[model samples]
Target: MTGFDTFLVADWSAAQGVRRAGKDAIWIALAQDGAVKPARHFSTRLDAEAWIAETIRAEIAAGRRVMAAFDFPFGYPTGVVEIICGAADPLALWDWLAARITDDARGRNNRFAVAEEINALFPGEGPFWGKHNRDAYPGIPYGGRSRTAEVSEKRACDISAKASSSVWQLAFPPTVGGQALMGMPMLSRLRRIQGCAVWPFEAWQEAQAVLTEIWPGLIEPAVRASDDLRDRAQVEGLARALSRLPLAELERMMDIDAPEEGWILGAGHGERLTDLARPNSLRPPPLRNDCFALPAGVDWTPVDTALALLRERLHPVTGTTKSGLFEAEGRILAEDVIARRANPPHPNTAVDGYGFAAASVGEGDAVLPLVQGRAAAGAPFEGPVPRGSALRVLTGADLPAGVDTVVLDEDCSVGDGRVAFRGGVKPGANTRKAGEDAGEGDRVLSAGRKLTAPDLALAAAVGHGTLPIREKLRVAVLSTGDELTEPGDVPGAGGIFDANRPMLLSTLARWGHVPVDLGRIPDDRSAVAAAFDRAGRDADVLLTSGGASAGDEDHVSALLREAGAMQEWRIALKPGRPLALGLWNDIPVFGLPGNPVAAFVCTLIFARPALTVLAGGNWAEPQGFEIPAAFEKRKKPGRREYLRARMRDGCAEVFPSEGSGRVSSLSWGEGLVEIEDGERHIRPGDPVRFIPYGSFGL
Candidate 1:
């Protein structure tokens, strides 16, 4: 009875700019049982919405069960509920944001400006950071700390393969913020459809068209990440993947307890998320107006959304100082690299050769007479080239006035400085002109640019003796677990060394942040709180591993809830399941999973981007490479998954197991073989997606 007769996938777009077919426009795909279809494109998002509406109605009328999965977030991070809707209900927040953001049926919209407007409320550069036509909002940094630090990112059932995007990220391609902003309105309409139900928020019904969110990367992570591939490939591929799903598996993914946070259809939490009998109460989820996120067990925030949300409260520090050119390299510039002088300083020869006026040689002449004094580099000829004469000019030498060209030595033979050359020489050949590379007073490099070798060279060439730069950030790490011991010390029976603390410290150091170790906790509540206080006071960011989840042994989390607010975000990520973001005495704390693999995944997927932003670096996703599979796998739908894998002989070979606790699997792989949430039956030779660990700097 839970099986669906039809499966449809929508590859959504939130472009507020020009739409082109087979590219920026929306595409949809459909499948049923053994029948699957290629993707169909629409000229406008509205056209696609209209088509979906028609399909839903037709399916309902025909007495067939239809399940539709769209590629936009159905929910945002926690606390955003209050900021967005002024309500605790996640669906209400969706409706609110959907109403404020406008997308015409024709695809023309103000999505970019709207992103700027949303960012205005956040504390830093943005939760949203890319755009094509729009300039960034003034005073808003190009890179800064996450605004939505209130929510724990990894708690949402998101796999690390495809991170979520904020609702405010309306400008960039691949970022689904704009799509969610614009798409939600249409989704609200569908919710009101005669026979429709949005999962988790709306209880499922057999006759209703069950609508859910889908991660396009779930089935084709690397393919979707490929620049050469069109998004329709994702739609068509995922639609086919869904159609191939076993009926039992399909039902399991659909049945989850996601009321405040909408669930992804193929998150693969199916068996665990299956409908469970529980007591119903009038009590509702808590809403936090404080700095920390409010806890809600079931519907956790997606990682991308949480990151954007986290960035909302934090801002890039405005600590700037002047540094000499030698010291400026590898630093973030605080002021524009203004040019004091033009490059080259004066017109000079572009190559080593003889310089002469083209008119000096007759149209029929093959050779020219000699001239006085050779114009070698650094030895300019103050006088003009005499009529009917040539001068030997070395490369980088100033071209004599009235000389319009330079003939290479290889092209001519000089006897006593007199040049004999080819039949005809080109005008202005191999010459350098005054201010050719840059003009005086030109802003060679803009402010906020991280000075690299090329950037330093550019600034130095323009006579910049010193540059202004921002200070580096200070980061601290804490590990909390009863079973953890220091690696240097022998562990007691049944205890393991605390791997996450040192690992986080090392990761922070690699990213140019000052790392301060807060040491480890032995699952004691009071000790955990005191350690948190110390970390907050000593570092710009306080990070903790283990005790992030609400287990009996999660003493740190229990203390966090008592001292400050703690939100357990159930990110749809494999290897990691929960992320905690909290504030103790106004200091932001990042809580990660206890498992070394999960902690590392969360740090890569959430913390890395956040740290970069805090250090005035723009938010970016870790890109993946599309490769072939060397092994087969069978998995359920509901949670995104990551498998340690190595590229071998042109194929991606996955590790034998998918457990997060297996640190050896991580060490054994060069990268990860990603399996997007949902039922999947992968086989050898299939085009599988691989994300290299090196891409994340692991």
Candidate 2:
């Protein structure tokens, strides 16, 4: 006899006595030699439980191990109300009430609580014969008086008791009646088996899918009725347990001998579990100190000329190498990529149909005999179908030899091993000829092009494993202020919180430069000088947000002169007019205005493109689109102005307040509309060019 392990699920419905079918259905699944068969269903709980117990006992008697899961709650919450009231046992009080309730005992004086007590002792037998009114059952203190209430309480107790007694490894709450009571015991058992309770069904399904992908063969084959519940709970428990277990023990459980190999075991699933990972910043180049103050009344270079100069100076530096596929997103290619081989290496079937020699088919009544062989994926036809012959092929199958045309299966008739095509078939009909996508050794991607997913796929198809990529530039960020405290800390009366660090980090990421935060530097010139020295030693570019202006306390400009050489200072711009550009040990340094909005604007206009140049990419300035102004605004004539403005209905609307010191204006504005050197008072409906936030390294 072949012994099999089987699980049975039984469903039951309330006994309404009108030939009612059970709402609950039980499933009996077979597990033979560690493999589970498709489950069979049963409509009755009694039948399911009986079969399960019988099978378990028989398996044990035959010296075979068997595990079963029962759908029920096992433990009862003994009624403290009755116990504390000094009533004998609650069950005794229950029985005394059961004897008094009769089917005809309804009316004003009917004692219903007594009936409820009786039903609690014997679930599934309900509709007590007692009355509806009473505070407590007669002669029983605190006993439920309503028949309905008593019966409900009794069923809860019964379900709980049944769940506690089931010795199965796992318990599933019943699908229907008494679910509330059954749920508690099942949850309790789950907590004991695995520290955490089961998640909701939807989340459980997702967790199970993830586990199956990562731990291919670890889980048993049987899809337990509660497999989703068990798998999710167990996986979470395993994660917690594994964290506590020694690395060696965890590796043993994962069936790995070394830690490196074990780490890779769950790599696929781990990637899906977390968000995208970013690479660490590369060390910056050294700087040279040769501070030279800006010449007074000097004519500043145009944006285009300045960018061209910066590009020439910075483009020679190279970036770090990364995997071609992983580096595809947000990375520009260093050189043009030519195809080493043509796409679709050979002529293949474009449709799942017949492949016939085009020359063999005549204009009228020409029938070609079908070859016995069929072509499918991975199986190409060995030889050409000779003249007057056809071969059957599926989609993606290689075209048969000497066949230049394919007649879709719908356009052909087959009989007696011969296929006849409909009229009007052309020589190259349905044929995807060679080199249709690209010729052999053709240039696929051009130099300086940003690599997208499609580009990565194309590169892989060409048999290239690694690609030459320009490295990411390192930009050092320093926030300077003696009156600033870190976020989440209590600040003194004169102190403000640090916001520039996070803001600069996000901005640098957008601009494709890796930002190395040097935290907050103090107001002292020595401390500032030390910061510049450190930045010069490691950073390709240094960005500071304060102490750029000429003031007694402002030290960044003075420190830059002391630490290295000054390049350009004091751009003729509003809000960020005090901006300073220099070099510290040969690394470029940008000292932006201390105001939050001004600092942000300065990074967008200057620092961002400078980093792009250092990263070996083009330094194209953000383009502006012309739009009408919603309101009139006044500006100085000689200086270039950037007003915080937003676009709506193709019109640029300046944010209400335009003060350089007002940080709140930044929050209200989307970007700035540059009013070049000649413009002064602009009226509503006037055409103005505005640059969007996204285009300006935001």
Candidate 3:
């Protein structure tokens, strides 16, 4: 169930500069109640270090559990840590770097000089390189790696990580060399702080405050244009992911045997992390086999995978009741509507004609006197025709007795109430036989079929005023959080419009389900629990957003722990990371993140499919089209992206920013550009998979 009491994620910077607000400095965010708290930026390394220490102490001393992640390499390749730090221990390198690498608040730092010093310890300029312009370091390679990492090794994770440049390459984009130089020093500072248990190097107990290495690429999201924003986004995303991670999964992440090459916090989690990239499970059906036990520590389930598993688990509503044929358009049929009587009840004329037995007619042209009485749609003649005579019949009228054939009145001249006909008259011509369309007691509509307009007509034709059908699904929508204000109301300082609730409500209605608006609830645990307890009695499903993170203020998450049950949270799909599924008082409940864009994306991805099944409809994969990328873009491996984009000039033009909080992007984007896993160098004309907003029924 629960892993950490207080969670923190820090986006680290290795670039040397007077940090104010950019990726070059530290950016941190707290994960609370299934969502991320607003980000905090540390302009300088010293400021970041001090804040981290204080924050950890503040939370831990208050009897809260703490787990914090820092983005950077925590250990080097085998033998490198031992040689440079005078021992093979991973923390030794941290201690060693802490004492060395003089970096200050000013942009000035001896990064190149320190690389030169570390190289001096090696036989010939090794394990690190790529010097800067003002660098004093010698024996540093300029462009690429001349040799591999220490002990000629690769991290177990390197094979799957193409976005991760080899640490041996040292500096520049994608390379960890510069980062290692700047990053190690900060981690080194952590070693000196009391009460911190460095992962892999030390055994991690839930009681001890823990510090682990994190790589953004391991759970990569779409790249953000602003450095500070990007850094914070990655950290906040990680924090939310780790909070819902299963303990068994966390154990695997902590069970790294290679102490020299400390594992990334979520490195081994890639297999499942990629699943996190899956869209959230919409009304996922309950599991069939005992195999329903889900893998632990998995936060992101791919949209496709989640759909397959969840749909397979569907325990479709089995109970049924009677509904009038006229009002059964969307209801699923629970039983067949059998024909009470044969359609038309007797042989009937197909069109207006003169009727007579074929044997009674002559082959050549002949004139016949019309019978005293005529057969009409609602009226029938009583007597059989004489051998040489004929009767006039109207469309849908029963044939007169002993009349087995009909002559076209149009082909003959009618004078003085008489019809002229040709001698050739076919038997049973222009007539519908009794029980031809539907026989007596025939099943007109089968069970498990959603009723359409034609079906209602068929039921009526079969003389059934009522039909058996399953009940309609009712959904309740709730938006939770203290920071939420009703949409259309001006948000006061630190507040946001509660967009997710109304949006979800409208979507449920659009799908032909009833949506009961529960409105917004402040970040109060009891209130959330009480609301669900009340709503579950009348609703088949409960949808919610906000206060889903693990932060102190995240009462919705807290309520889930105290009363309700939580099934899932966190996914690898872009725009929506904090998504939770659970049950409240036997009612299926879906918890979405607070960010409007993320909420919307998750709704379309997961809620749509899930709700469809619940509404007695089959689950179908979301349809998408292919287009060319209108602009240049780059992304790392290990995750899927839902880029907000519009089709412009036959190409998919994406919104420049990946921030889910920006409401304008939802309106601006026609749909999403789904980028799959692995490194991508998207040019202006590269083919991109696109799914439109309308496809989600926006």
Candidate 4:
């Protein structure tokens, strides 16, 4: 649970016009609390090293655990080389070997050669050559490896795997490869031991390629000459070491001291890092029913107006309560839930068979005297059976005392006083262990989780008599237009069958709202006013389809102004336009388009989110994907457009009939292609963004 709090990154660079130059380090301290501390620069290795030591010391003193990274070597020399490993002491055996080699005898012969050559001469016997040497030597004396060496290696490997996996899993193409490449660098930097560079250069290159493929944007910008060389070396070393270490061991090591436990470093590095990066969870806002007025001469005015209208109209109503298990079939939870008791409260039998001590079962058709012990749904055995004894049992029967295994009836033959088993039986077989299904104090449901059938059953199993759930919103739906008529009813001349009402009603029900049908009202000013009056008195929200435009027949707008306070703002979107939003007698009213298709589209674009808000849920603008277009089209500037499109062969193909009135276009559509306002034209095969309806939870 403890997460990272900060990231201290050192970007080492060489000063300009400097040859054979050491690094000019750039130290960046990133606080998890959203503060970016001033960047510190060092012109020389000594300065950098001193600064790092001081910073780490200060951080440690201040109760802040800091992870300090350096763009230099940290691994012990495999040969005679002493790499830039941490401040840990070398192994005891290594120290002894070094003493021997440097002594008059060995040093005179090969001590002058490079560390690699000297190591080659002695091989396993050399201080810095092999694992055997490390095992024999004592690590840094103050922070001895005896206590933490095993744990650290394990933690490092686990962290490496998690980082790699997370990067590779990004859906965005560039992100995947970028992370893959960075994996090597991260590993190399973290796990550089004294005697071995477990992660090598080769592995780092491979990871780099993967990182480049996944996140070109990130890798490209960071791949400057000053930092590239050190980064490559570091990543390679880390990746190679990680590939070899056991993931579990690594996790254990990192878990040793966590922030929650008042320790500086924690386990599950990726999770910790994410916490450090963003401590707060991202929560969206609730949808609103506020309308935007359409300008004159605009044909798509209803869409914007309807959305604005819906925001104010959909106010939250009703109170939250906990219902009985059987009654909470379709309610969202108001709070988290923990199991009152463990499931399968006690150990019980899972099979219908004899339950006897396994030690009593003998080889080859053994027959023991049968005991008259019964275990039923509510009854359990009271006493243990004697040796060479068999008990008769049924399904759901509790295992009798002194019994460990159960031989199925089909596999056993009844005898004079015992049941003979035909096959071998194991101890504790066919037994349902207590707390296996659900542990005591286990969280069964988190807060805000919707209660489903399985959840109800789980709650019952945990002995819950009732479950708390959020209050449902009270919504009143009204369809407007003289041309609209209910389905299966004979439509008079100039009347079209109503589709928006039924569709809107179904959608409302799905969103956990108590919807009231206000029926249909003709496109008359008085009728619209009467509908609003009825909705205001009866429902928390009033929803209407059509009459949102400024046309003379669009009376909902005028009625809204006559009844209550309303403000309208035009949203730059496409498809269902001419939206009208207003409030009537303290009740919000959303006036949608009369066209069935346009009305449905607008509802999804606006109404659904607003309802979500009314239901006390966060509602944010939905996200979409940018995909290659399969068709070319041109549009007027200054308006956002949504075209129904199907993804064919990974390409978005706009439907042939691309009009707001064509409801069928949406029915067969996989997603909506979003053309930004003022982007007048798009060519086939061009990349355009699209929002899939499913992403909106629709």
lDDT (tens digit, per residue) of candidate 4 on 1-698: 11123334454432222223223223333333324444444444335445545555555455543434333222222321232122233232233333433212111222222233333433232322112133332321111222321111212322433323221111222222122222223333232322111212212211211101011111211132123343332222222222212222223433432111011122233321211222122222322333333346655433445455445444444345445566566666766788999987877777787877778765556676788866765788778867778787777766667776777778878866667776467677777877899999999887556578998889889879777665555577888778887899999998788888788877777767667677788877887787677666456677888777777987887776665455443556666565667777665677777777667766778877776656654553678888888898998876767788778888898889866677788678877787876756788788899888776655
Q: Candidate 1, which segments miss by more than 4 Å at Cα?
A: 1-298, 307-314, 362-365, 433-437, 440-450
In order, what lDDT does every prediction score?
A: 0.70, 0.54, 0.70, 0.52
Ranking by TM-score: 1, 2, 3, 4
Write the residue-wise lDDT of candidate 2 on 301-341 in tens digits: 44444445555455424444434365456676666677777
Which should have the higher lDDT, number 2 or number 4? 2
- lDDT comparison, 3 vs 4, better candidate: 3
After aligning candidate 2 to the native by TM-score, how far in Å is the CA of 532 from where it should be?
Answer: 2.1
User: Could you tell me how far off, in angstroms, the CA of residue 586 lies in candidate 4 after the best superposition?
Assistant: 4.2
Error of 3 at 608 (Å): 2.8
lDDT of 3 by residue, 1-698 (tens): 12466678887766667777765557887865435577798877778878888887877787666777877677767777767877788777766766777877764667666666777677754666665452445556665546443455356655445434666655666556666667777766664556667776776674446887777776553223223466666666576566545343465566667678777766655433432322222333542332222467565666666667667765553235455566578777766789998887888888877887677666677777777888888888887888768888888888877777776668777889778866656667788888898988998888757678988887787688877665556777888878888878989999977878777877877766667667688877778877776465446677788777778977666666565365554566777776666666666677778888888888888888777666566673688988988988888876677888999889999998988778899888889998986678899999999998777756
Q: Cα RMSDs of all predictions?
A: 25.0, 20.2, 28.7, 26.1
Point out where model 4 deviates above 4 Å: 1-316, 321-324, 334-340, 356-370, 385-392, 400-416, 419-427, 446-450, 465-472, 482-497, 509-512, 523-526, 549-569, 578-586, 616-655, 666-698
Q: What ranking of all candidate models by lDDT puts the best one first?
A: 1, 3, 2, 4
Least accurate stretch of 10 residues (summed lDDT) in model 2? 208-217
- Model 3 TM-score is 0.50
